[model samples]
Target: MSSSARPARRRLQRAALPISAVMLLSLASAGCGASVGGAPPCLPPEHTVSPSSAKPGDSVTVSAPDAKCDPRYGEDAVISIVFIDAAGVEVLNTTAPMADAGGFNFTAEVPLNSAPGVMAVNAMPHGVDWCDDTGKNNRVSQGELPLERASCVLPTKPLNITK
Candidate 1:
C-alpha cells in the first residue's frame, strides 16, 4: 500500500468511529431496557426534591416535570431514582413509571440509618444503576451502567439529611 493510501486508511478508520458511535447510539436509544453496542440510553428526568432537606427516615416528594425520553422508550416506560448517602452507599432505589407527559412524581425516604449530611440522588432508566457506590471505592454492586458523559442527576439543591 502507498504511503498516501496509509494516511487515507487511517482517516477512514477514524471516520468510521463516529459513524459507528452514531449507529450504536441509535440502537441503544431504541431502549430495549438494556445497553446495546456500548451505549446506554438512560435519559435522566428533570426532577425536583421537595423541601430540599429532610430528617433521617423522613420522606420527601420527588417530581419530574418534563421528563424526556427517546422514541424507543414507551409512554409507560419506567425510571428509577437512586439515593446515595454521604458514605457512598445507595439507600433507596425507586422505580417510577412515566405518565403520558413523560414525567414522574414520588415520595422517598432518606435512610434512617444515614448520617446527617448531604446525599446525592439521580434518575435513570429502570434496571441501570447509574449512581451506585458513588465514591468509586469499588464496593458497587452489579449492573452499574457505564455512560459516555451526559449524567442525568437531579436535585438542584443539596439534599441535606437533618439530624
Candidate 2:
C-alpha cells in the first residue's frame, strides 16, 4: 500500500494481463487448426446413387452425405454424370453443384440423345479422387458398379415423366 510500491504492483498486473490474454488466444487458435485436440476425425463424404443403372431419358437420383464436419473445408459438393459410348469414348459429361445437407439428393434426366452404349454412373465426394480409373468410376462407396448400357429403344411401357 506504500506509494513507492504502488507503481511496481501496477506494472506487474499489466504484464500479467497481457500474458494471460496471449495464453488464452493461443489455446483458442490451437483448436481451430486441422484435426483439433481430441476431435472426431473427419472422413470424406459418402455418396449413393439410386437405380445405379438407367436408360437414356431416365431419371437418376444421386445422394451424398453431409460434408460439413467440425472442420469444414468447403461447401457445395459437385455431382456429375458422364456418358460413354460402347468403344469407351466419353460422349457427354455434366456437372452440378449441390449444397451439403445431411444428405444431398440430385435427380437428372439422362439426355435422350446420349449415345447408346455401356456407360458408368458415379457419385463421389466433389473434388476427390473417388475411383482408380476415370471412365470406370462408380460411386465411391459402391467401389465399381458394372457399366450400364443405354438402349436405343425406349422402354416398352409408356414412360411417365414428372418433375
Per residue, candidate 2 scores C-alpha lDDT tens digits across 52-97 of 5567778867666665664343475565545443334455567767
In order, the Cα lDDT scores of the candidates are 0.56, 0.44
What TM-score does model 1 achieve against the real structure? 0.52
Q: Tell me how candidate 1 scores on lDDT.
A: 0.56
Lowest lDDT 10-residue stretch of candidate 1: 27-36
Error of 2 at 4 (Å): 89
RMSD of each: 13.7, 25.2
Model 2 worst lDDT run, 10 consecutive residues: 150-159
Q: Write the per-residue lDDT of candidate 1 for residues 16-38, one digit (tens) a residue.
A: 33322332343333222222244
